[model samples]
Target: MARRNDHTREELREMALASAERIIAQEGLAGLSTRKVATAIGYSVGALYTLFSNLDDLCWQLNERTLSCLMAAIKEVDETDPVACLQGCARIYQAFAEQYPERWRLLFEHRSNTDNPLPDQLSTRIGGLFEHIDGCLARLYPRIDRHERQLRSRILWSGIHGLTQLEHSNKLFLPDAMTAEDIRIHLIDSLLAGWDKESHHA
Candidate 1:
């Protein structure tokens, strides 16, 4: 086993995080432990402590990296057509959730036991998710006010998230009727069409 001094603090931090992610990916959040991470990185638990305050801090950092990956994935989608872009973004989000359920759950399902709110940086990064959706809505409906657009983004995301949980639990009305994405497509189209119809009637 390599001594802890073999690597710089930053390198050790990265190594620990990577090891932790692999452990979590295979066994879910409950499987993660500071000792496991330390052993995986060939370092002592004390050395791991130097990198993170506690397990919660480690999880927080893990979630931060996951969020960055998600945002980058969204940015990679072509946005020439806002409508298609919106649908593409939705699909990508769903794909990410399905591919990395444990990581995705770590972002949301895993919560710190502390009473203190999350770091402002993390809170702000989470807000970016909703803001991205808001921007997409602006392109689709120029006349929609910011407040309304923000609310719409939340509503749309809430629906998608709800369906995702239901899908995973096999709790949807029709067990094998359709995928969450299929229902999401119909839901999005119906909502968009309803808005267009409302405008016409107005």
Candidate 2:
């Protein structure tokens, strides 16, 4: 029988990440540890160190992965109509947060001091999303100045992020309980209404 290389470096790295996500999902970020990840993956702590320098590094990788997935979802939105594209983007953003609460928390909720520099690939991934939004705004109102278009895009993004964060934290209060989907749709409508008013004023 051929020798079994039960643990390659790449394989171990994948296992460590999977374990980290599992731990975060089950017990929240406070419960995640290198030792726990190693144990979960049947590897020693040293093995984890060989792949990642520290828990922060591992978490950074996980956050990057989460962002990549979010970007992909945003890119998948249809762009036929500017308002529809913005609404779709907003819906996708909230859906990601609701579906992967722990991962989303790590990505956008927590403020990390670690110098987890975003890789070029990840930067490009996010830039594409912004570019699509900008394109949509430009198409909707060709007369709008470049600076105003950028401002509107930023405002929309900030609105979606704020609402998603509030909803995820369960701190959002209305007359009645609102599902994430409902909140997403409401926010999109508000954004579009503001955009329409601005367009008419211009």
Candidate 3:
């Protein structure tokens, strides 16, 4: 390892996070540990503790990056119509799960090693994702009041995540059936139709 003073605390923190991400991507969360991260980052376990409270904190930070990456992907869909934009973002989300299956699973599937709730900063990042969806749904159907729209966005997000999890588990289809992408698009279309009708009655 290089001399301890070669890197600042902030730089060491970044290095540790990057190393942890690489380990998780290659070996899933099962392969992550403070020891492994410290070894890869050229810092001792003691040094790592200076950066993160514990493994869970590092995990939350990694997941925050994953959320940012996902939000960036969906925002780049480049659709003009609000309905189309929302649908396009769904497709983008589907692709993201395919591209980074482990990272995607880590965000939702991995259980915490402790009982502590996520930190306030990380919790805000998670909520911001739903808020993004809330905005999109509001734009698509302005009659769907804010409270109602927020609830709907959570439902929509959960449904898509469930579908993705099923796909990863190799249980998305029969011998001959619509692909996962097809099913996702169909699900979105059906939900949008129902939401549109619901808005009129609001």
Candidate 4:
């Protein structure tokens, strides 16, 4: 290990987070522990606790970073057309899962306790993702009222999420063997078609 003074507290915290991410990616969240993170970062467990309340706190911070990374991915989708943009968002999400399976899984699967809920700030950050979809839906159907846009956004997101979960779980057994991307595009296209019908009816 390097000399204790070689890194400041802020640097040590960054190191610990990075090391914890690696451990989770290789061994999963169940395998993560403060001791492992401290050892990897050349800091004592007490030193780590000085920066974070506990392992749960550290994991929560990591989850926040993960969400930020996902938001960045979604933002990078270059399409402006509502349907294509939404489809691109789904494709980017699937790509993120494939590229960082462990990190992505931690977002949905990690829980400190079954009864305890996330902190309000974290919950709001998670909700921002839904807002991204809501914005796109609003652009696509400008005449739809805010309540209807919110409802449609939630419904479309659920469909995208369901498809992603099925793909990740590897239980999407079908005779035709459609890939995840294929299913994502089909879902978005079908939803758009239904929305068009609704708009015409209104």
Q: List the residue pairs that clash in candidate 2.
A: none
How well does model 4 score by local distance difference test? 0.83
lDDT tens digits, residue span 106-193, model 1 = 8887878777679777777789888888888898888878898998898888888887777766688775666677898988888788
Return the TM-score for candidate 4, rounded to 2 decimals: 0.90
Say which prediction, candidate 1 or candidate 3, comes out ahead on lDDT: 1
Tens-digit lDDT string for candidate 3 (1-202):
7556889978988898889889988988799999999999777898889888998888888888888888887777665677777778777888888888878888886677789977787788788878878887887877767888988998898888888788878987645756887888888889989977877887
Error of 1 at 45 (Å): 1.3
**lDDT by residue (tens digit), candidate 2, 2-61:** 112686878777878888999999999889889999888877787778888877677778
Off by over 4 Å in 4: 1-5, 114-117
Error of 1 at 24 (Å): 1.1
| Inter-residue clash pairs, candidate 4 | none
Ranking of models by lDDT: 1, 4, 3, 2
How many clashing residue pairs appear in each of the predictions shown? 0, 0, 0, 0
Tell me, by lDDT, which candidate is best: 1
- Measured on C-alpha atoms, candidate 3 has an lDDT of 0.82
lDDT of 1 at 71: 89
lDDT per prediction?
0.85, 0.79, 0.82, 0.83
Give candidate 1's error at residue 90 in angstroms: 1.1
Candidate 3 residue pairs in backbone clash: none
**lDDT head-to-head 1 vs 4, winner:** 1
The RMSD of every model to the true structure, in order and in angstroms, is 1.8, 3.3, 1.7, 2.1
